[model samples]
Target: MTLVAFRYWLAGMSLALATLVTPLSTAQAISPLGGPRFAAVLMDADTNEILYAEQATAIRHPASITKVMTLYIVFDALDAGRLRLDDRVVMTPRAVSQRPSKLGIGVGQSLSVEEAISVVAVKSANDVAVALAEKVGGSEENFARLMTAKARQLGMRQTVFANASGLPDPAHFTSAQDIAILSAAMIRHHPDRYRCFSEQSYSYGRLRLANHNKLLGVVPGLDGIKTGFTNDSGFTLTASAIRGGRRLIAVVLGSPSGWQRDRDITTLLNTGFTALDIRRNGGIEDMPALLSSAGFTLNRSLRPVPQLATLDVEEGDGE
Candidate 1:
């Protein structure tokens, strides 16, 4: 069968198998946060088919993962000739005053649009994020409105953007499914620009900043994406990988720690790829069995609940 035909068939089969699996109950749906604060989704990026989900639609804080949408808007501006890579983005006092995990660019100092993108993608620079927002939307407040509009346009019904850098706000929120949709949109709409997410480190003058997503090089087939954390959001990640031309997007939100978050997403992607292979070779019946098996379950008992003090300061730096 042709590749397109095969993908369509596979999507149908996966959806059918999804119907057979029982949804997790409120008690069983608990996140590593010791509550129902977590949500996860694994999707076949190429087909946009959901392979597995746990409270995927639950609302949760997005933290610095909000930068993905920030960059998306920047990319759109670049594409429309409204912005240029070489154009300078000046740091306003407001941008410079943003919290830690920032570029530390001073007021009146400036960086090129391209440099701003790299800083935001690799370092999760909150200051640069605000600069980019202001550059694109005149003000961060207006930029957030634009972000919400774009999210709606992208069909992210549960997502609402409140800031450019994803600082804590009771108003800001998104879901695992919505984040998966955003990740897929980034891959689908801005394949070239998406490379920024894979950058391990970025340098400016005397300072060198590293990317927070640690699994980029360690996990085979894994590539560019983003990570986030906050007192309200916990640890969140949206990752994408490709193997044998098949790509998958996995999102894990509100984990207790970065270690558990990374580990959970890794497991999700690995299981997702294995399930795809089983569906492709062994048949659709084998796929569901694999996902439902005891071996595929995430071990939540071992996760340690972090201190409230730590969560207050752990936004974009650690992962």
Candidate 2:
């Protein structure tokens, strides 16, 4: 079924099952890990409701999660007919000079846009990110400007992009809520291309680059998205999952470790799904109360959602 039709059908099913949903016990609720650097936000993809949030609006480094926005620009180019998957993306010296966690393609070598996207999405290839940036925006610096512009256009007021690969720059930062917005926009505007994020691995020549996102096959209904890390950002992840025919986007940033980041995201998604079910069934009045019952510490001062302007873990200097 078409996505829209499926969403409509899912809404109906949710409402029908609402009356049958039992009270949520403590056993059913998952509490996320807490940390000084931790920030997160969970959103219902269909309704854009903020289901759970903790330090969600605080500024934090994005790490390799920057690639999500990079990919978004590429997807936009594809939609505008300026880019094609089969088109060649040459590896420039600058792209090759990028840090590790790269595809290792030679400076002069080339790969199709499709392959480039896979390596960036699945492998978190820094080199390929720069190549794609240069391809689309002439240089990484210029591309970053475009990234920031797109962020503003999409109502992401707190984000700023300093590079295409999300390498550490004092200027490159975003909040968890902003990341959730970006994730939803990608799924909303480019469902087809977004599937690339779900790929577990990508074959480029003899190398089989595995996705850095460890939760892919392990978490039920969890699908495409991204993972990132750096000394400054800690371990971060933006995950999307569909349960009970509803999709939710969860973003966790600045965890102390990769495993913890994954764990927090899993808990957030689970808690979010349960809360959504309860809300649909008329068992809850407000999200704060539900989150409290689920054992989450809420930062009661949430910033108001702005009107629309439009729209991983790892080591080294890259991930």
Candidate 3:
């Protein structure tokens, strides 16, 4: 090659190397751990640094993941003295219309706020979500406005909600990053209610249900948040775990099957938790490329980053 051509190539190579070596905070440097083909994100529940992501902001219907927002507003009401666990909530016809993954609540049936929460958190109950939404905002439509307003306040720019039940509204959408941010908020803003995520099962009346969040019993210190599924959105999960004093939140959306979604989430948790100081094995022997190196490390802080970048990119542009 000519001297000029060689020098130009060398300069370009050097520039690329420098870019790779530039210092970055934990949130900015780490890429998504596994290359799943849909929206995903993992962040420090404490530091709010994104540890991993793939299409984190790709907006899609959240299915029951909508309940996370429902729980958020419910938590707010509890905080403001508008509601309480022991307070009774009467089911309305509108709440009964929500689709399945429900408590099968009858019209006029009443449950304490705490009882309703258990049914929704563990069972992913559509009926219960509507009831909570109504109790807080006087109607599901009004509560939805509250949910959207809260989303904007939390910087979930890619998210919009139409109902608390999270039924298949193409109009109701959110990103994995937004859900992670919401999950972290629920944990910090309402510890008492967030603990409900860790419970494996609950029974009300004649019905009993296991928590849809598969990681609850199997994953160490994984509790808080929810799971979701639908024909269009595939299978989805939002998971959180704390290990060695560091808390991490992970969200996976649009997996092809419920079992596969559970498996993918399990892999991420295994890597981010056990591999904190070394290499994250992700508990699988053959998928080394899917797992992260064991050496990633960061400090544990009680505070999450409060000011987030405006998540303006929508479904098409996000990731």
What are the candidates' C-alpha RMSDs? 9.7, 13.1, 16.3
* Candidate 2 residue lDDT tens string, 1-319: 9853553355344333322332222111112222226688989999888887787777777788899999999999898898999999999999998877788879789999988999999999999999999998777876777777677668785677778887766666778899999999999988988999999988888999899898899888998799887666667899999989999998987666676668778877878888778878988656666656765555522332212111032344445
lDDT of each: 0.79, 0.77, 0.69
Task: Give, for candidate 3, the lowest lDDT window spanning 10 residues.
Answer: 299-308
Error of 2 at 51 (Å): 1.2
| Predicted structure with the largest lDDT when compared to the true one | 1
| Evaluation by lDDT, superior candidate among 1 and 3 | 1
| Candidate 3, residue 314: how far the Cα is off, in Å | 29
Q: Which tens-of-lDDT digit does each residue in 52-100 have in candidate 1?
A: 8777777677788999999999999899898999999999999988887
Cα lDDT of model 3 by residue, 1-319, tens digit? 9853553355344333333443222222112332123567767788787767676765556778888889888888888887887998888998787667677768998999989888888888888888888888777876777777677678786777778877765556777899998898888888887888888889887777888776776778787578876654556789888887888888887665566667767777776654455544344332234354543222211123222122232211111
Question: How many residue pairs clash in model 3?
Answer: 5
At residue 229, candidate 2 shows an lDDT of 70
Error (Å) of candidate 1 at residue 307 is 5.6
The TM-scores of all predictions, comma-separated, are 0.84, 0.81, 0.75
